[model samples]
Structure formats: C-alpha cells, structure tokens
Target chain A: MSRQDAPPIYLDHAATTPVDPEVFATMKPYFTEHYGNPASIHTVGQKAIIAVDEAREQVADFLGCKTGEIIFTSGATESNNFVLKGVLAAAKIQKPHIITSTIEHPCILDTCQHLEKRGVEVTYLPVDKEGVLNTKSVQEAIKENTVLVTIIYANNEIGTIQPIAEIGEIIKKANQERKNKIIFHTDAVQAIQYLDCNVKKLGVDLLSLSGHKFYGPKGVGVLFVKEGTLIEKIQHGGHQEYNKRAGTLNVPGIVGLGKATELTSKNRVADSKKQQKLRDLLINSILKNIPDSHLNGSNKHRLPNNANIRFDKIEGESIMLHLDFEGIAVSTGSACTSGTLEPSHVLLAIGVAKEQAHGSIRFTLGKDTSEADIKKVLEVLPPIVKKLRQMSPLK
Target chain B: MDHFRDPHNMGSIKDPDGVGEVGNPSCGDIMKLYIKVGKNEAGKEKISDISFETMGCAAAIATSSMITDMALGKTLAEAIEITNQNIAEKLDGLPPTKMHCSNLAADALKKAIADYKSKNK
Candidate 1:
C-alpha cells in the first residue's frame, strides 16, 4: 500500500536526477575487488589511478576541454567555494572585488557573502523580469578592483537560460582593458546535460557541475578550470586532484560520474526531445485549464525540460500537496531549501511579485517521465487549484 | 509519520458523524478526515468510524493517518481538542519544518467536527 502511494511519476529532475542504469553498471566493479587507492604507487593503487585518469579524460572530452583543466571535488558547492577561496587567497594584497548575479546558486551567494565578511566587495547584478542578466548589466558592474565574475549558466529555479556567450564577451572586453583582468565563472550544474555546455565557446575561466544534477551519483562533481586561470585551493590536505583539491579520490563516485557523463553525451539529444514534449504539454494544458496563469521565462530560451507556471489565487506549496495526492511529483524550485515555506529567491530575483511567487510551480521533466504520467497530472491538477483557491485565506 | 511505514485506520468508514478537511492548498499539503460520531446506545458521543485521505509529503500523510487513528472511537469533544502539537508528538515529533502539517490535520479536524455540530444542532 505504501508502495502504491509512492506515485510512479517523477518530474523533479532539477532537484537531482536518478543515476542511469548504464552508469551504475559501469561503476559497480570498483566498489570491491577492483578498488584501490589512486594515490599509492603499488599495482593496486596504480589500477585505481589508471581508472581515475581515464575518468578525467572522459569528463574532459565530454566538456570539450583538456584533461588538466578538470578538478574533481565533492560537488558544485565545494567547487564554487574552491574557486572563490583560491582567487581570494592568491590576490590577498589586491583588495579584490567579485561580481555575480542576484539569481546565482546559494553556493555562490553564501560564499560571496562569507567573502564580504572577510573584506571582499561583491557586486550583485540584477536580472530582468524574466530572470536574465544582460551583458550590459555585467559590463556595467565590473570595476577596477573586480577580480572575478560568477554567474549561473541556467537558473535552477525559474529555468532562465542566460546569454552566456554575450556575457562572456562583455567580461572579455572588460578584462582586455585591465592589468589584472577579471576571471569569468559560471555555475552550470543545471546546464551540463540539457544545454550544450562547451567551456571554451562560453569563455568561462571556471565552471562548477554537480554530477547528481545530471543523473550521476551524489557527492561527486567537476570543477572546470580553464588553462592559465589563476584560482586558489581552499582545502589543505593530501595533494589529490593535482594539489588543487585534497583528500583521497572518491574513485567509485568518480567512476559513476564519468559513466554518467558518457551516457548523457550519448543520450542527450534524444532524451531532451522526450522531456521537452512532456514539458510543453504540461505548460500548455495547465495554461488552458487554469486561465489566470502565466509562464515565467522566455519560452524559446528556457531549458527544454523546465516548465514554470504561476496559477493565480493558489500557493505553490498547496498546489504541490494537491498534485502530490494525485500521485504526481513536481517542485516549486530549489529542493535544497524545501522545508522553508518562503517563495523561491530566483522567482523574486526575476521581479515576480511575492504573491505570484507563492503561486508558482516548477514541473521539470526527466528521462523516465511518460505521457501517461503527464496525463495523470492534467487529470487531477485543475480541480485541486480550483478547490484550493476557494479555500485560500488570502483571496 | 506512521502511515509511511504502517498506515492505520485506512479503510472506508461505514458511517460518519463528522468529517474534517484541512490543509492549506497554498502550502501543498492536505488531509480529508471522515468520522463516525454518535451514541452507541449508551448515549456516549463516540467516533464510531474513522478514515482519511491526504495529499502531501510522506510525513504529512502519515500524520493525517495517525490523527485519524488517535481520534477513532474518541468522544467528539475530546477529538476536537487534539492539537497539531499533539498529533506531531504522536509521531515521535515530526521534522521541525513539517510541524505545520500536524497543525493542518488538527485544524482540519476541528473544522470538520464544528461543521458536524453546526449541521446536527
């Protein structure tokens, strides 16, 4: 019965996608007999070391970068911290400044906030009504002391895909005029699988990706450091990840991550089309049934799988619960801070009024989402919204 | 909540004296409670039957189910007094953030019982 209550529909891919079976299958052997410490020079260690090197090569190939540019970390959160800490530590005497956007992940936000306490000035560029930071905003925010600019490639909350190429160009032009050019970074945790995330074309000096965000295992991530980028290492320990990050390699997690990268590269186009259709269906149907609703981002520029809707007269959490009863799984942005009833910061960043922010719902499609699942969602959601609006105290 | 592991009083009730539908749709958690309230010949206001349906997180669903179990066969007045805190305590204390879910069940119960009393009187 409990299993029955666990609805088969899973539409919350942005929170964390399930590991592909193929990736898990590729990673299984390393858990036991094939396991060895990558650091040790012994045959056993060399075996693991060889696997690690091969995984790094695979990861680099997937990202269209050289092997040396990659640094494995716990996840994107750690990678963001590493980049911020590394640059801050190296540029101690310069009274460095950093620029980021209001829509950045908390990893970037909190890290910058921490840096502010430690004497670093941070310039927060604001996004437009659609949650997009224009290149002009970025260019205007850069200052003489600005050492770096960290922005999200795609917003996790509202699914706003930033104009990275344009933003990248603006920063490059800004850097050309300065002696200590500002480094460019983007947290593309949500862009790796869905969007074609090529670091060179994007011209980002540093980028962070959580493996789990792209259907790899949790606790494993990649920090893409462009060659010649000056960044400092925050953690001091055994020189793993080229002395850039410390502690023994998470060989098993790295293997899973590498496998996941390969699988995503292989299945990205086909799987994206599959999820996109479902996303469009959900968006269209919800708008049709719930008339007083609005789409949150530029339809053309958003992720294929992301469909954010604001149903007037209803709250997101209440809608979430109502749909949850109908055996559907969706999100309202940022599962990282789910327990908090506060509306999403990304929604607020995009200039969504607090009322509309409370009413928003994010339906992110994934590899396993089916048409039937979406049909079930459509079947049960409209009535729930109607009923909830009738009960809302705010109304 | 217990329902996640072993849900209690889950079947359809034969008859009901009061029913509770509480949970904020804006918050994405809801519970519907059906109660059978009447005197079993002894003039006691016993909740003769009870069942519930909930839409929310596992914790919320379980809390709703637990509250129904606690209120089944209970006196109507006694059932109305069950606080959200009491329902949460029954679950060995829910996660701090989900405390409102317990309140949802209790609040819905109060509404249902009051509805019942108003209609019968």
Candidate 2:
C-alpha cells in the first residue's frame, strides 16, 4: 500500500472524473487545429458550428431528446440557476414559488435563497431517514403559483437515487387536478453517467448535467429544456443557445463532452456492473473488518459506485489524510466555513447527528476503477480507522 | 502526518488533579485533556503527568498530542503559557485552515491549569 507500489488509487470520482483518453483525443483537434468561434460565419467558424451541432446531437441522443431541446452552459450550477430563475422570471403570475429538497446541491438551495429575497417563496421539502423524498410530501407541497419543482436525481454525498419518474407522475397529476402548470426539473449530473436518462419517461421539463461528472472536460454542461417551456434569459449577451443562454461556445469542451457522453452511454451497463461488484466488495469487507462502522444512505436504490461509511468516534478528515499518505484518495463529508470545518448539510438534513456527521467518508468509484484498487483500499483502511479510533475521545 | 502516526501523551491519566474538555463546534470535534500536579524540589508546581484524547482531524489530534508532550514536566505557569503557535510549530506548521486545532489544544491545556488552580485555592 505504499506510494511507490502504484499510482494513487483514486475513489473521489463523484467530485470530478478524469477525462477519458478517447475523449481527450477527440477534443485535441478542436483545441489546436479547428479553433474558431461558432458565432463567426467563415469556413472555420462553420466548422466549429458543425462540431458544436454534432455535440448537441450526441448529447441529445444520449438523453433521448431532440437537439433543439439541449442548451449548453458553463456547468450544472449555471444550468440549475437558469432553470430556477428563468422559470420564475418568466412566470405569468406576480409571485412565483419553488419546491426543492433540503438535500439539494448548494447551487439549487443558494439560488432559491437569492430568489427569495426578490419576492419568491421557496419550500424546502425534507427527505426520509434514508435520504429518499416522499412523493406524498411533494404532492401536498404543490401550490397554484408553484412554477418550478427541482430535485436532484441522485444525491452527491449519500448516493441515494430519488424516485424521479414517480415524482414526475405526481407533479403531472397535480397539474391536471389544479390546472396549474408546475414545471419539474431534476439535476441529473450524477445520474447521466450510469442511469437511464430518458427525459420523456422521467416527465421532466428541464434536466441539468455537468460534463466533468461524465469524463468530459470541465466548464461545459448541458441543460435539457423541453420544447415550449417558458424560460427567460438569465445572461444578457450574445444570442446563442436559442437566446436562453448567452455565451460564446466552448468548442473543444463540447466536443469532449459529446465523445464522453457517447462512450459512457454505450458502456454504462457493463461499467456499472463492474463498479457495483467492486463497490459491494469494498463495503462488505470494510463493514466486516472494521468495528463500529456503518454504511450511510440506503443499501438498495443507491448509485452503483458510491459507498459512504461512518466510523464511530473517528473524524473523516483524519481518515482521508491518513489514506492520502498511503497514496489513496477519498473524500470527507464536511466543508469549510469561516475557517472551520462543518459536517455536510446533506448529512445533517438526513438526521445524522452533528458529531456523527464528522465521521462520514465517501468513496465513489469510476470507470477506471478496478478490483485491485478496491483491494488496496481495504488493506489500508482497517488499520487507519483503528488507529484514529484509538486516539478518539469517544472511544 | 508522522506526529499523527506516533502521537505523544495520548490516553487518559487516572485520578488526574484537573481535567478540561473542549469542543470545536464547526468541525464537531471533541477534545479532553487531563493533568496531574506535583511539586518540584524548588517548591514550584509542575505538570507531573499529561495526556489527551481527541476526536477530530489529523491536525486536531496531533496538536492535542503535541500540547501534552510540550506541557509534561513543565511548571504550571509555563504549561499554561504555551500558545497555539508553539503547538503548530511543533507539528511543522499546520495548514492555515487547520490552525484552529492548535488553538483548541492550547485552550484545553489552559483550562486544565485554571481548573487546578481554582480547585487548590
């Protein structure tokens, strides 16, 4: 388990993934040789436009949507904001309300907070102990002026997959009952790589995904806006992305995204099966070997690659650093605020005690992950957890 | 990181003269420090024994271990005078973000000394 034995065994894929080699090769030409602004009308620009168009088609095909429905943005944050704010601003009513979960990404929660200051009412629905949103709660929270309902398809920290299609059906039935059009949105950034993302079957009006999560380059994402959905332009600039989003195209990143999307879509089933086997092995071995440790999130209906574990009487950051010294990479379920680290809001919302939240560690697998990597982690982890626990106050 | 591997003055001291418990709210870490008092030949009070238990990041545990090692066998005044900077320096300087761990260690030692003084008085 020494650093010299092998390269670092990375398990933080949920944060961001390395670009696939094929994706990099596809994007290489666009960066150097075919550099041109899509807005420009010349041949080089037309070439760039052609690439962007084909990328759009690739992404659209992956999502089972038409090309015109996909709008490229900087990333999921921008896409989430555009959908939340755009729909609110364009609503016919004087005051618009939004419904989102308590465990959404900060982009959605922070954006809701920002809009609330400007005369919008937001309802943050709570999740069950297992981090699953109850459809009955969503059904009861709908109001006449509720213009948008945005929820994450899979939680980043816990890896719990929300019932998107069921929630969609509930929203559709509510709309039919009240005759009020409430748009459904899901941040599918974590789901696009592994889950089936048929927009029609999911019954979502808008879906957001980031390129980096799917082995594509950073700074590129797609916002699938169902046709005829009323959304105002958030950025006021050039007339791109059907006048909904304004920015010059990122030709190379988009090309990379296209290839990444295509590769992931084709290999998802086999890759997920492999990752699931490794994930379960790591989980079972750790739980059996390590004392006083339990898994976070639901055992079933979770992402194939995620394993969030909590060790009693030990802090996750210490475990992460100890693993880092062993040339293994993992993530802690805590974020810094005002120069002090705080447990993740997602963990807190799921009824994990504040102190227990400090002990949460997340290990997310990826396409490149192998069984040997999982074995290496299992070998290094038990001793680290034991050592940290020996020094802990609770123990 | 090495200090984390072989921490000094860790665990609890039975029948301690003074004990201080501290918590870092943001990180949700708890640290407890114990001190046993003794009088030297010069008739000055000294930290006869010191140990710590911490539940936190590497820096927090290291600082707790560092502070106890720094305080053991030192005069009560000297032990209480050890600052967060000294603890951080002993650990080869912690990340700026983890500086609070050193602060928590210093505060725990200071409170232990204060508890000893008040109880004796």
Candidate 3:
C-alpha cells in the first residue's frame, strides 16, 4: 500500500515539515562517500569545498543573490543572533537603535527584547487587528539612532505575511538622509515557500532561513549576508563562513538545505496553489462545524499553507491532544511557546481576547498535503471539539 | 460519560459532602471527586460512598475510575495517602507523560480528604 494511505495525517508542517525524499537522496552521499572537511587544504578537502560552493550557488540562484552572500549556520536562531550582535560591533553603528515588530518569531522577538536589557534601544512596532504589519508604522517607529530594522517575513503562529518589500523601500528612502545607512534584516523562517525573496529587489541587507522550516533536515540554516554589510562576528572560532560564522560545517545539513531551496524555487507556485486550496477546504468545513469559530489572521494576506482558527470556549492543547490521538498533528501557536497555557503574544498583539487566544490552533499545510487528507481531518475534528467542550467549564 | 462512568457506581453517591477539584489548564484536564461521609445512627463516622467527574483521554478516564474505586470506603487518612505512584502501579503504569496528570489528580483527592478531616475535627 502507498504511504499516503496511512492513518496519521501530519498537519503541523510549520512546526517541522518531513524531510523531502528528494532532499534526502541528494544529501545521502556527503555523509560517508565524501566526508572530508571543506576547510582543509588537501585535495579531498578541496573536493568537499567544491561541493559546498555548488550548494551555495544553488541557494544563491534560488534566492536571487550572490553565492558569497549565503552564510551557513546552525539554524535561524543563530542567524538572527548573528545579525543583531553584528550590528552592535560595526564601526558605524554605536549604541545602535533596533526596530522590530511585536509578533516576530521568538528567535527575533526574544533576541531583540534581550538586547534591550543590555542598554540597546529597541522600538517594537504594533500590528493591526488582523495581525497586519504596515510599513508606514514601521517607518514612523524609526529614530535617528535606528541601526537595523528587522521584521519577520511571515509569522509562524498566525501566518500573517508582513509587508516586507514595502518596509524594505522605507529603509532605502531613509538611508539617503542618514550617513550611517540602516541595515534591513528579515527572519524568513516561515517564508521559504511564498515570499517573493529577491534580496536585491526586496532591498534587504540580511536574511535568515532555517532548513527545518522547509522540508530539510534540522540543525542547519542559511543567513544571507549581503556582501560588504557591516555586521560583527557573533562566534569566534575557525575562519568558517568567511569569518562571519564560526565552528565546523554541518555538511550534510547544508547540502539538504540547498536541495530544499532548489526544490522550493522550482515548485513554489504550484505547491502554494495546491496548499491554498487544501487550506480553504479544511477552514471552510471547520467554520461550518464548530460554533463561534473565526479566522485568526487576514484570510487573504497570510500563508497559503496556514489556517489558524480560534474556537471559543475550548482549549487549544485539548484540541491538539485529541487531534493527536486521532492521528492528526497540529499546533496551538508558535512551537516555541506551545508548552505554556498563557495566550500567544501574537494573538494578543492582534487584539484577540485572552480567552480566544487560548482556544487558537494553527493548521499548516505542506508540499505533500492533499485534498483527501484535509477531508479526513474535517471528518475527525468536529466531534472531538464537541466532546471536549461538553466536558469543559467554558461549555 | 461526564461523571467518571464507573459502570459499578457512577454518580450514585448520596449527598457527597466531601469533594475535590484539581485541574491543569495547559493540558486541559480536570478531575472532580465526590465523596460522602457522615455519622451513622449509632454515632460513628463512615465514608458512605465516592464518585468522580473527569475530562481527559481514555487513559485519564481509566485513571479516574481506578482512583474512585480505591477511595470509596477507606478512612479519610488512608484515602489521603493514595498517591499518583499508587494509581500508576495499580493500572499497570500509565505512559510516562500522563504520569504527571495522575499525580495531580491523586493530590487533589488527598487534599479533599484532608479538608474533610479538618472540617469534622
């Protein structure tokens, strides 16, 4: 029987998509057959270097940037920290002012918040009720000391796609008046499939991507450091990543990320259309079956693969656990804070009531997700919600 | 099904004066224990009955069943010591993660029994 006919349907792609079979096939040879370190000067090492560069070139082509721009790191979290710390060390940016949104991934939001504790000034811009981020508000939040404006390309919890291109332009216009040009950065951990990520076109100076967010292996990510951008070294070890990122290379993971990026570039348009259709199917059925259900983010200005819903008078973890028992995987909000009972900050940022935020669930579709799987989820979920509510205090 | 559905004595307690309520909002599980205790016509205290209402997984429901059965007729002191480890050991051991819920539920029951003892004294 085909694996597609299996019972448990995975709906939590945002948490982590299964490694694509295509990516695995491409990465398999590197672990054993060509295990030499890329940094060594020997011929075997030179061969590994060529393989790494080829993958880098593939990622660069996919991102529409120079091959020299992509710096491999552990994941998006490190990339984000690198960018934030890098600005602090730059010769031009002294006691830098950083601007970020309140609803960014914890890696971005927490990093910026922590930086504030160390005497670095930070302004957290607000989003609209639909979790909508506006460039105008971000522009207004910038100050004379503003050093870097980093925003998430898409929110992992609510799936709201920020206006990154517009914000990029705002930074560009502002740079003309200031001698110290403000660097633009984005945590595109959730935008691998949808965002129009032409670094030159988007006018961004730095970008962060995690392999696990796409259908690749974990523990590997890419940071697009625009050539000549003034960012400091966060880690001081070997001369890896052109002295930008330190430590030994994760060769297999880097290869997988490159293949995954190549696959995304090739199939994003078709895959997004497929996921959008499946997302709507599940969403429409859920709204019809569950009472007091509402979309958490903008219906149109969100990830095509993501459907976040708030079901009043119910708990998200209960729903997730019940769904998990039924062989369907899902999420309450960001995986970063899914352990807590407190409402998601993203939901709260968008003006969702505290009770509604506790009831939210994020269902993210992926490359292999199908219409059949969506229909099966619709069949299994309503009764679980009804049964849980029937026994709950809010009922 | 709302009341622990103990096919043997589900919600059959008469005027359950002793009760317990403990819940975890994050995990979305709540267990409520109902116990009856009063002095007989001859002027001696006895636990007349016990029951429960729990909202959780099948394992949780089963755990609730085991708890009510264990608490039904015991002296307040004896019932108060019935712990999560006891419940798991009784039920052939719950999966590791569910062990926490079992402990929380047992603690709630013991606290209820203690509360009852305090009121009587």
Per-residue lDDT of candidate 1, residues A4-57 (tens digit): 455458878888988888878878888896789999989999989888888999
Each candidate structure's TM-score, on Cα atoms with residue i matched to residue i, is: 0.80, 0.96, 0.86
Better of 2 and 3 by TM-score: 2
Q: Which pairs of residues collide in candidate 2? A: none
What is candidate 2's lDDT per residue for A1-395, written digit by digit as tens? 23556688999999999999999999999987999999999999999999999999999999999999999999999999899889987898978889999999989999999999999999999998889999899999988889899999999999999999999999888878765589999999999878989999999999999999989999999899999888998999999988888889899999999999899889999999999999999999999999888888889979999999988878888889889888889998765322546678888888888878888899999999988999989998999988777777785
Report the C-alpha lDDT of model 3 over A1-395, residue by residue, as the tens digit.
Answer: 11233567888899898889999998898899888899989987877788889889988998899988999999999999989888877836457799988898888788787888888898889999888887788888888888899999889988899888889999999999988889999988899887778888788999999999889899999999998889889899999998888898988889999999988988999998989988999899899888888999898789999999988766676677667766788988622134443568899899987666767889999988888889888888888777656654444
DockQ of 1: 0.11
For candidate 1, the docking band is incorrect
Off by over 4 Å in 3: A1-7, A91-94, A334-339, B1-69, B80-121
Chain B TM-scores across candidates:
0.86, 0.94, 0.77
Give the chain A TM-score for each candidate. 0.95, 0.97, 0.96
Residues B57-77, model 3: lDDT tens digits: 444556677887787776666
| Model 2 alpha-carbon drift over 4 Å, by segment | A1-5, A177-180, A335-341, B24-27, B89-92
Deviation (Å) of A274 in candidate 2: 0.9
| Cα deviation of B116, candidate 2, in Å | 2.2
lDDT of each: 0.80, 0.89, 0.80
RMSD of 3: 4.2
Please tell me which predicted candidate would have the highest DockQ against the true structure: 2
